[model samples]
Target: MVEFYIGTVDEMLQSTLISAFPIALLIWMMTKQRALPSHIALPITALLVGLIQLFYFHSDGRLLGANIISGVLSVLTPISIVAGAILLNRVLAISGAEAVIGRWLDSISNNKVAQLMIIGWAFAFMLEGASGFGTPAAIAAPMLVGLGFQPIKVAIFALIMNSVPVSFGAVGTPIWFGFEALALSPSDLLEVANQTALINAVAALLIPILALKFVVSGSLIRQNLVFILLSILSCTLPYYALANWNYEFPSLLGGAVGLMMNIFLAKANIGLHTTQNTLNKQTKVPSREVFFALLPLGLLIVILIVTRISPLGIKGLLTSTNAWLGIDIGGSHLGVSQSLVVSLENILSTSVSWSYKTLYVPALIPFVLVVLISIPLLNLSKTQVKEAFFETGQRIQLPLVSLAAALVMVNLMMLGAEQSPIFLIANAFATLTGDSWSLFAALLGALGSFFSGSATVSNLTFGGIQQTIAAQVGLPVNLVLALQSVGAAMGNMVCINNIIAVSAILGIHHKEGFILKKTILPLLVYGGVAALMAIVLS
Candidate 1:
């Protein structure tokens, strides 16, 4: 067993700052030097972290080795989902789905604003329901690009919108797994969901304004305020209601239902597309072509719904059983046993057991199924299939390597938090806030997502701390936890892995800093509102 070296707040603070050096270096190099994270920044940071653990912290090679191994293994599920998304995009691209989708958009709306609300806000909400592990942007950003929007804008918009629906991501994983893991009762769980829904509802309504002003004219936004207001309500109302009734279906049903309502309105040319413009000029296209174009998305949605809601326990069938291959390090092994945890004293409190679940993950079935069926249904030839696969393999090479390195840094920090910078940062925040921790509740939540690249992991890190702080400060535990959940959900907008993946998928290539700069605006707005709401609600 590794000895726990308990340090004073001052010593821990110094250690934490030193530990943060790697991250600071990464940011400087990414933004200032324009270096590729995968090739240069990330690898260097990982090495520096390893040295920090070994020399400064005196952590044994075994613990450091386990941390690296666990960190690499942790992203397998997301990496699998991303690979599927990339494959789906590549297949769709070669199959001429974009042309059919473009015609479909023409048939629906000529207005860029209208298209964004549908694709950026509503459509993404549905995908978020289906798979919350950063897969929504991978799927939705390309769709918006097909509609003639800038890839960067689409990436930013989707990333921001993705934050609001994340509490219910992958079928309420953030709440069901993140919060419930804290041992809250049913009543407490419901309360947390309720407050969380409220926070997201506010963000949902505001994101459209940003999407409009940025994508369209400000004058257009002012003219379409009523329509925009109604559109937001159309989504958020159903989302909040379903979150209370069944957290699993808010994004699923809310997104699907909201899309229908908005589609009906857009078809009538209600807002910016009130007159058929060049962007949405009517084109002669067959209904069958439209359906064929949408078949892949159709398959994805149907598979998600059936697996998610079926009483036959399809979700369970897919969710159970880990494909764990253990990592051996100094008599301690780490692996992907979803429910199993490996804890090392004064190191990671609980390291998740993980393995490549190519067969069981929810994303695998739809993406794989879509690709296989598309070969016949979309009339894809053998040449096209090989090309798509080859292209995807090449495109994903940099992102996978970069993502793995970044995740390693995060895991090292999170698992060894007592001796990491996060500990110092959290303490500093607590000291600064005192009785006012509620004010920064959401910001802290966002910070977790930013570091861990997951709202669920954010909750895992902060839920207990939030609950304890709430107790000491005389606030409702559920309310504070709700703020944490909502804040972390918003943090998804700026998660490092998310930015990198979005850039890579959209072919932006090493513009993580630029993406971060664009996204931080909405991150601020969302966090600001959550902070204010926390003050009142908590």
Candidate 2:
């Protein structure tokens, strides 16, 4: 067993910082050098490190096995969902549907403040719900860029919007990976996660206004108080309500509610606000036509929700499918028991057997919906559709590479390190804080985000550390881990990897430090709130 090592406060701080420094340096060099693309750097690093584990560490088997599993997981589920989402976005983009939708929103209130509230907050959240793993940034950042917003601002806004839906992201991956895999009971896990989610939701309420200030400054906040307040309420209230009752659907349904609320609020305020010269109104296309053009997205949302929730909606189809996969666990060894295969006969078999239902689709709802809706709306020739598919394939290439590389790196580090790196680091932290697990949890949250390059991944990595520490200190594990995860997400706003990626996307080089400086407060605010929650709730 990997036991935690308690050390002096100075020692803990030093070790934690040192353990994190290598990854930090990589982030810095990638941003500074601007030589090789990160897509290439990441995999190269993974391979080099894996080689070290093989030769020097004498831990090649475990490390290599971890890499294989992580690699497979990267492609198997999350990657598929991301690809489907991007394909849907591409369809919308190609069809000029995005412009129409933007124009219609622009029509309701041409005021820049209103537009920011709608787009930065509501629209972004909707994308977060529909697709969580980097899609919000990929989709929303470009739209903001087209809106004449600064790229740095767009990146910042996207990151902020990205936080709210993270717990339920990618069909509940975080909750599944972080909480479910633990020793805790399901009800306890759900309650803890939901409470943590509610806290994050409340923190996210300020995002619209904060993003506006970052994008347009303080004046915009003052100018659109009603709209902004309403927007925040619309987002937080329903999100909290849905999360409490239906944790599975909170982010998904909440995003749609927020989007609709923004639309309604915008339409109601059609002539209420006087425009400032700095914030000009964008032109509008016909709302109904724009809505029609977005039929694919609407269809996607409907189908995903129905297929996931409404059993009767897909009951007959699910009943006839007998496809399933599972690794039969024996002793120390494991192997793949089934491989994924698709056949028309399998598709046909779904209509008559519920036992075979798991094989029926596997979230093909987005793929099917995108193709069906885009064909008519995009007015694409067969050639154009084929090209779109090709483009979609190309677009996912970097993500595919990045995901695989990230998995390999994470797995290697986890398996080959001399100890549970996080545990060693956390024990050092606990000793330093005199068993103040809140501080340790906060620090773990920050550390996990730094390493994993994702809040959700961070949660999965160090959640147990926080829980373990809290238990040792006789504090609440759920609250501490909850805070850890929330702070982890907040930490993403400033993580070197995230900063570099967003900076590059926004065409901002050398100003990453500046962007980090700007975001530092929000990160602190978010973390501070979570830390306070850990303290007060305890």
Candidate 3:
């Protein structure tokens, strides 16, 4: 195995620039006036990265093949999650449930700003915590569009609102699994959570304000300023407090509490001064109709909560791989289990592997289960069910390709060499920034998610690097990790895979670049605020 030597200044600079070219090309092609469609641009980018890995990085054909295979396999999780969300949207749209949901929201308050805060901000926050694989945008964007918001604006806002909750998203996977390789003590991990929550809490204030700008006029936002402040505090205060109490459940419970509080405030018209109640003249919806309309989503939330809370033991059962059958072929091992554990080990005779807990992934257990259960409960005709499935299949086609390409690019960059391109870039940043690396620490985290499409993956990829840099630079390690986590969460706004998924779910194709243009500002602001907060803590 040949390592690209970065032991000298010229070598480091050369390595960093060479490694960064693919990412630069990707962004340029997407955001240019003649914007390339994600499905097109992403594959081109992936091929470029693969070529660099093979040539510049001196990677073997076997390693390259393994990484490509791993990338394809890894893509299944996001694609399935997106597919399930699309299916649910189809079910809701076909069954008239979406209309009922829109009206239910209107009944609470017809103020568009209030509705946006409740659903896009608070509701999306809770969903991100419970099921965060781009699921929040998948669920919330369509709901907002059904309420008469533009699909493009809704898509942008959904992605932006998904940020603050992401570090603790999927029941804190970003912390627990993201830092698992660090081997931190429970106490240190808790401190990371606490600092992450504090940083997010500060960034949370600006994020809602920014997301609101996409959906509502500045005048309308000003009219509802007090209510908006309450809305922001409702989530962030509890979110911060919960981080102190435990590493998990800050986003989940904070969003839950915020949803309830915001609903009450909106209903009472507290702090809502001038916006007219547009639904006031409409007849009231029956309780049963609302219940049935909300049933599938309600069930999904319940299932996610039940399975995630460790005391319940359901998470253990679903994730357990204790019983399995093992086999070896082509110098690789495979494990198949009755409990739905599937593992592939030593791919192509390299120390690379993958595993899928069939029951544990949110795509299968919650999203897919909710869809299946909704069929009988929603009482859809066979034709309607077919239509839903057909539409879901159609919508997922481009996103599947784009996601696969994006993940392949990510894998090639991260796993193609003993010192991958990602590390080279991080090292370059640290070397260039030196004493001021604090300002750029979060940017490194954002860079990770920009390519990899996940906060958990971002933290896992860069956490050790951030810790090492912190030690070398005389900064606190936990604070730096927290900044990394927060920056990764913010990166969700501009993540190519997320942009692709949200655009797909909204049935708005070829506007990924436009969405990225709109979201990049928020990402910058979020990283800036988080950096300042980290510096303060330091």
Candidate 4:
């Protein structure tokens, strides 16, 4: 194990300087360079950070290579989900589901504000649950544009709504993988989820209001106050309830049913009492086409629910690995590896993983199954199916590389860098804040997400540090961890991957910084809400 030093003030400052370079470089490049692809920025940053660790922190090169390899492998599940989301979205569009959804926009509400509630707020939330990986912004922003909303406003709403369900995103990947490294108990997971849900419960109320203000300058908010409250409760009540036992589905199920209920209200013209603009002239779509187009989404929901929640022993079968793959490089999850042991069970292994099962991840099995079934059910043409498959694969290539590199960066800072410069920063914050660290705990968490561009990575990077601080400072451990999760989720708005997703879908690659600027206010709102709540609850 690399020695963790608690050195002098000068040593601490030196450690912080060496460690902070890579992260600061990342932020500067992403915000300053208009055309630098994430795939490029991330990998280079990873390499640079590794070098800095070797020379400055005295980290071992071989171990660093192994950690980077592990980092690349660890992120496969989320990367697959991202690819699946993009493919599913392409398939839906090919089957006219995008158009079908657009047609329903006209039927739901003539008023733009009401329309934003359903699609941008509720429906976007649903996408965040179902496909996340920034897919919500990819889907919702274009849909809003089709409804005649300005492109900028569409992007803003999509990015803002993304904040609500990020911890539960990609079917709770963040919640699961975020704390997986720490190996927290299931009950602790629930407690963490409860705290995150509490902060998001406020978000459930506040997001729609923010959306309305973005749409019409808050004039229509009073007239639609009841509608806002209802929308909030609809997502909040079941969301909190689901967090109690089923951490994966609070956002998934909550967003799914919330979208449906909100759709029902909009179609029934329940929330259209105040505004009467058609938003845009759209043709009435046939119910058959809409249902067929929505087959993938419906199937995705059914598959996730059944596989994840059923007591019929379905998940057990799905989770079982016929073979275990083992890596020979000597490294351990606890710290450094000792040896590469042979697993006589079966032939399933990678450079980073030993005894890993085939399709061991929840996301891989369900999403792949959903895609195969969806191809035939959606009546997707051979050409269209082929197109969607190839297109999604192509689009995700750079993104997957970017994500892996980001994970590599995290692992580099973690595994063997002597607890990292980030840990030192956290320690300093804990010492500085003393009794009031709650105010900045979430900020640190947000920075983790911002730098890594993943809530799971953020959690993996900072969860233990934050936990250590909580224990040292006598802060509420669960609540502080909850703030970490929530802040990471909120960081989705500013994360490079998410920004790329939104901009890629809208065909506005240059507006990344512009989008970042507009979305910061909402991030502050979300961070502020979580911070204040953490202070009060603590």
Residues 155-248, candidate 2, lDDT per residue (tens digit)?
Answer: 7776666676766654555665666557777777677667767778777766556656777767666767777888877877777787665556
Per-residue error at 492 for model 4, in Å?
2.8
| TM value for model 4 | 0.81
Error of 2 at 283 (Å): 6.2
Q: How do the candidates rank by TM-score, highest first?
A: 3, 1, 4, 2
Give the clash count for model 1: 5
Candidate 4 displacement at residue 303 in angstroms: 1.6
Better TM-score candidate (3, 4): 3
Q: Pull out the clashing pairs in model 3.
A: none
Q: What's each prediction's TM-score?
A: 0.91, 0.77, 0.97, 0.81
Candidate 1 error regions (>4 Å): 1-6, 33-39, 273-282, 322-352
Give per-model CA RMSD.
Answer: 4.2, 6.8, 2.3, 5.4
Candidate 1 residue pairs that clash: 335-353, 335-354, 336-353, 336-354, 337-353
What is the lDDT for 140 in model 2? Answer: 61
RMSD of 4: 5.4
Q: Report the C-alpha displacement of residue 533, candidate 3, in angstroms.
A: 1.2
Residue runs of model 3 more than 4 Å from their true location after superposition: 1-5, 278-281, 416-418
Model 4: per-residue Cα lDDT at residue 425: 61
Q: For model 4, what is the C-alpha lDDT against the true structure? A: 0.69
Q: Which candidate's lDDT is highest?
A: 3
Error of 2 at 218 (Å): 2.8
Error of 3 at 315 (Å): 0.9
Cα deviation of 325 in candidate 3 (Å)?
Answer: 3.8
